[model samples]
Target: MKTKNIIFIYILLLSFSFAQSALKIATVSYIKGSCYIENSIQDKSITPLAGNSIMNNDIIHSKEDSFCDIIFDDDATKIHIDENTRVKILSDNYSRVFEVYYGSVFVSNAKTHIKTYIQTLNNNIYVNNNNIWVNSYRDFDKVVSINYNANIYNYISNSQIILKPLTAYNIFSNGSVKIDNNLDLVPDYIEDESYLQVRKENRNKYDVYLNDYDLIPVYGRETEKRSFDDNGFKLGLTAGTRYMNNNEYLTFGLFPQYKHNNFIVYSKLNVYYDYFLKCSSFDDCEFTESGIYSNWESKNDILEKFHLRYHRSDYNNSFSIYAGEIPQVTFGHGYLVNKFSNYYEYPLRSDFGVNIDWKIDNDFLNFKFLVPSIREYFRDGGIFGMHASLFLSHRFPLTLGLGFVMDFNQFSQSPRVYDVDSSIDSRQIKAFELDFELDIIRSMNLDVSIYGELVGIWYPENIFYFRSDGLMPFSDDLRWRRGTWGVMAPGVSLLIDNKHEINFAFNFNSAAFYPSYFNTNYLYNRSLYYLTAQPFDFNTLGFNLVGNQIGMLNDFAINSTNMEFFVPKELYPILTNKINVFPLRGFSIDYKYNFRNKIEYYNAISVYTQNVGQEKIKSQTYYTFDAKLSIKENILRNLSSLNFYVSNVFFLERDDREEYTFGFNMMFDLPSDVYILFDIGQVFYDVSLNGKRNNVLNSGLQLRLNF
Candidate 1:
């Protein structure tokens, strides 16, 4: 008797071991079209096949026209997925937990005592060995369970419903709900005969994948899911008419895009023509030369922006390469270079380059080589730069980089509008920059961060240019000097959710740092030194302070400048006998209030005092104030809107310098695929020399469509 009992115990222990070894969470029973499994632990996607094991935290994605079937090992429960769906496994232990983020899914547990739970954004459905079909769209959800009962809980309203078998329920994102007993004859939940026929035809293929391929799914799907324009093309068009300052023009634009796998190609083209319909040539149009129309300028037919890009992601690492007419976008405190749009009109700004980015782990590497002008080649000048940064912690990142600008014509441009007008020889500049980024605070409702950068530029004969006397041509004591100077800026930002925030920054420049040559403060476009003292050859030792705040009700900004001391110099012919200097001081503040519904108000004031060539002897001060009010309302249900705006500008010291403007705008989105917008305004400028005020009509109409 003792021997028999011992044998029974051994057999039971061996049976338990076998059962544990065979227990799989779930299996990929069938797949149609394209599907993939994203493993959370591995941070990668794996091609799955029939009989493939599903693990905890696995995300299943089905592309358009695709389908997948999953069967649990413990209870033999089945789940059928429809096209464009994502399901995540939260807990696959005893009682299963699943989240269906989009599309539709069908779950069935024929046997009693089996448990299943499915969660959506607003509700939770629990199946006590029941069968259910769920469909989730943008803001609407539907569920139908046949042959078995289920329980559902609304997370938002704390409501519960015991869903009986053969019934349908509708759940709205806005917290409304309904249930009905009648079901559709061809409900989307049930597998149709067409799909079953397809399954029959692919039975041999699935069997091969399960038995011969060892449950490894075929590599037909290139990515984990399908992109919007995957292996397809899209096109967009924008046409408009604009009338500014009594000048009118018609604008047309086209944006086309195409994507294939990990590759993308896109272009933007724009054309502008005179509204008078008399201008034969695009360049001959008066509006083309106005410079106010910055979107695009027609060269021959239109402006074209063409770029080819390749992007790939796998295993937590990503890489992207872009070439051809790329935008020059700089990040992480533009100490070295800023996009040309910051300083010039967009139509004149051109950049053709190759950009490369590679990110792995916590480190990122970036490189850029751009040509500002294609006709002039490298001699016309271009920028070549490389940058690297690493995240030391989640909230703190450190970065350092070097950049070089090849310039053979820095001082050779003809004197024109917005020109710095320097006589320095062809010179190249090499710059080095360092940045420290820190996130000081992060909470559910608030976030704060600080960023600082130190930058220096070096070049030959960068300072102390020679004074040419014409006869001798140059003075020995005033010869060029090679030097380096740095500019430093420290900025802090605070945010209370998305609605409110504040930012403050202070910039300090050393005396030897020349703004005209380096264009410091590229981030703000303020360039106080370049604007005031660049032409006078005056150097500065001062700081500029800027602050901005955005609240639920209003937005405000303050820009202050004070160059207390300057390097004394002689005014060409006026102040040669006495010490010459320039003192710069200015402050500007602006405020905007948003009622969050239909009304907005804005006001701005500025005061500046710029002293040149003997401060107390020659000085000037100016003041300006401006205000605006805007009101808007919805015209249709997310289909249209209308707005009215009024504005006034006043010059305190100049008589008849006040200006006023009023405008109305309308936007229409009645057609789902296109948008139309129109604006009309009248502007009253300062009094003309004829003792009469000048007024001009401003109007614009634009239509945009995408496919």
Candidate 2:
């Protein structure tokens, strides 16, 4: 009888222990050093031992160089805390809620049904795919990594960034973020089976899968499934017509593409025929000018584009190589190396080169080297360009950038002329730029950027490159030239509710700090609204003040006469050979309001002024205003759209040069993938032209087929 009573008591005790454990949300599975647990409900703090039960509202602190892991019992969700980190478990019901104060944490919840919520100083991250890592740096930057797409709302910057699969993002408090592919701290790569066994032995737990390749799919599934048939054939065509300035032309193009798993090949031929250039017979046909050919498609008429490209990457995206033509290349917000071309002036442009991207454990690096030249006009004149960027840390990342472009003609002793000849001396036009970015306010949203560039002509004949206005003149002389530029900008950003944001920066530079020929100065502000269901809402409004200066080496003889700010040495003698001393000011204000569920509207206004010391150049007050409206609908089994646009440009002190343009465009997309477009426009140049009822008509039609 005594033995039976003892057995009954033992069973009751076991049941009680199991019930208590079930009530706890999580337990400290592993610990390294200096980990403390604070219970807000109890108003008490204690050092947590491994296997200690933890409930909601429990704050965990990992001191310097310490580490700890918390495992939720209901699901196998695990949270790893890094050194100098504080995290509080707000709730752990159907979803887990965590607030990270500082430091880094890695969360891996492979259970698809489990959801995780992380709140940082500036952003809130929603994790639904189970693989995620978060780092809060000094409360100013929030950096995260995930294996799949996730939603992140930045409250401080009023913005959202869709975290793509196998990508890392460094989000700032002001809504500015940098994106990189396939980089993770703490080695998120899948462990080998042997490694998992060792982990299980060491921690007394075996939960994580060793072969987690699907956790990160390099290039995604579409790239893997897309393959070519035996013929490897695809075709596209576009035909268009235009009537403008008492002239009409027909434009047509044919494009053929071959796609495969490892490589792609394509070619395009475009031609435009002018009605005035027609001949009575084929033998009597004549052409005024020949079109240029390139390795990439030309935006202008009469051209051919032939390209071959190959790419390969691993599942985790540790290595990737791209060869052949790349259409667009931009660097560091286009401060340097924006290779997009303006076909109106430069009809020929191409990027023929190779790009390499790799990651070493935690560090990420990328390099691109290209020959930015047209293929048909090939020459051995020696032109090359390269750009590279590197990141050391995802949180408080130290980023470095470098770019260079060199040409052999700019420094030639022989005077540059329109005609090509053997007399042109072979000298190097060496240009290089270096930049660094650092987050100074570790706990706030503030960053400082510093850059230096030297895009100058090197004269081999002259040992010294600089002389006074009297000794050497730039417009006439070809001796030593000065071309050094520097820039320093400090910026701050603020956001509210992840929907509204404002960014402000003060820029000081020797010239307008854009690597491209046409670019806006610093202090430029713009707003954006992604189209959504509610179209009648006012989406964006912004204003900006800008400062500008002309650089010393602004004279690129190729098109110097056509550029507005390209001041010859003789025109601005005092401003030569200087750094960060530009004397120009500009400001702009813009707003957009969308109305009607089926229509979109946009409006903007801008103004610019020049300052020569204390004097304001009244003649340089350039003003511009633009407005556009668009509508889309389904009509007669076809997707149809109509667009209207208008722009006006004037000067504050002048009226003769004022210009206005009005345009209307229509498009129809058929069910068979054929598209038809038509555009008509009238340009009224100046008030005199408008008074005389003189307007130039410009109209065009385009037809395109795709399969």
Candidate 3:
């Protein structure tokens, strides 16, 4: 019995020794998109783990499922996991190390803090784990981080290992073992000096990253960039009150857009009523709505929330070149055409137009036209062009600062003419202009332009018995119309620069509309000349304080005309043109001073005439004031204001008695990104007579929520 007991005691000690583990243990199960297999079991390196496996510092296991043939992408490069392999992410989200048990895998060594366990022996390699870890010995002259608490391990290197140059032996074992804080018997270090301090202060700085590549949903800036891989879309709204006939009414608007690549399909609709809590554009926007995703990316729209009240288009589907219908009216970067808010009166001001822009060789060609076939059906069709125009614009390097614009307009098709002078059958106007862009000095650009025009008339009423190509013969039954009559006008202008130029204009009037060189703002007779300004990026403050004001001035001086009424002529030129100085281009500077109502002095130059016809012998000027300014535009807006004015006039007869304006009024705007709009408008009197003034006000308001 004593002998048996002794045998059992010895067996017990042997069992205890065999059971002791070198590290902690755990297990994991397989999920989707992976497979596992068990193959070899030699030196514990070839053993396969399946269904729920775990380890710590010693024995290792595969990821998730026991079987392991996995694929991962990142610092180690695209790695292919062999059948039945075991590896470990030894470091937690707070650690910077990974551990590989044993297996054959392809690894592409990369230079990044985001690293992998399969160390690089060369630029590239595929290994079976025989022995391939760089010689990370002692790191004598290096300042490396050793986060024992975080990594659960440390580095150890002796003089012998350091001297080995490029070699490492089995680490941490019994018998000939000598340990001094060395992990995997390997020395780890970093090239940075303050690494240790950084690791100590920040715990999760090294958190292992897992993204969509891992089969789970993730969100971030990078994720956002990927979401809109194709074209983007925005379902927004546009609502605002339009002042007409001196009355105020409520307005509601909606705008939705779908964009793919550069192709766009957008539509807008607006409804109106009257008087609420101060009226503006869009009574209710889906800004704060729930469920929908509102991103800074949505605002990524190159253009901002515009007053889109109708369907408008500018691009055309065409080959490199095509002889399109209505070959005239070429375009160069202008969006939208209704310059004034009072479009109800100018019903035919819209146009069903198409534009083509293509560049080949060293020349860039662009052309556009309005289709006469589509008429009143298109709420946005302009009738002015029913007459005619043939425009051709070209850019050349043949001569320095030398370019030309040729345009031809004729009353080729007279379907209907409500107003006509029986003197001519059909009239045609043609002009050709040349410009030399010269840089006299840095930043001082000068475009010297010279052009001549030819106006030919066809007579439908004449005294002859037969009609000549230039004349229509008169019969007792049919009155004769004149044919083929003509005139020529030439002009020149000096532009300091292409961008917001300091301009000077000198034109000799001859025909109604001759060439574009004489167009005060390049705002009309687009038949030639093109002016384009880059839009401001959200991040670009744009000349700091001149953004909103820039748009307003351009709207009037270059693209849209302004109105100034109520201030008398004695104070007109001084209060207006003096302040506006010469709005040859869309640019303005303002100055203000006032001391109570008794001594009120207001001066403003709002570009009022888009065009003054050469034939309009009766020249005139009437005072008018109506504008909207807001801070929501990102800068330069304060004390929302709405004021009315009545003034004298100096016209064809230099009469001071023929002008007046009474309109609706209200004002307001918000901080950044929020809209606050105001309107003060009305048309009191006209017709080369006396002056008058009328004023009215209406407003409304509604909070918005984004979608």
* Error of model 3, residue 613, in angstroms: 22
Residue pairs that clash (backbone atoms under 3 angstroms), model 2: 156-495, 158-498, 465-480, 509-580, 510-580
- List candidate 2 segments past 4 Å from native: 1-232, 242-247, 276-304, 309-325, 342-363, 374-377, 380-383, 410-428, 439-481, 493-503, 511-515, 518-668, 677-700
Compose the digit string of candidate 1's lDDT tens values, residues 182-270: 33422443534112223234445543211111113323322122122247888989888776534577778788999887898987676
Q: Which candidate tops TM-score?
A: 2
lDDT of 3 by residue, 179-295 (tens): 122223232222121122232333244432222112121222121122323356666444555543333444565656666543555543344454544334667533221221111
lDDT of 2 at 301: 23
lDDT of 2 at 227: 17
Worst 10 residues of 2 by lDDT: 521-530
Query: How high is the CA lDDT of each candidate model?
Result: 0.49, 0.48, 0.27
Error of 3 at 259 (Å): 2.3
TM-score of every model versus the real structure? 0.42, 0.44, 0.31
| Steric clash count of candidate 3 | 84
Query: Top model by lDDT, which number?
Result: 1
lDDT of residue 192 for candidate 3:
26
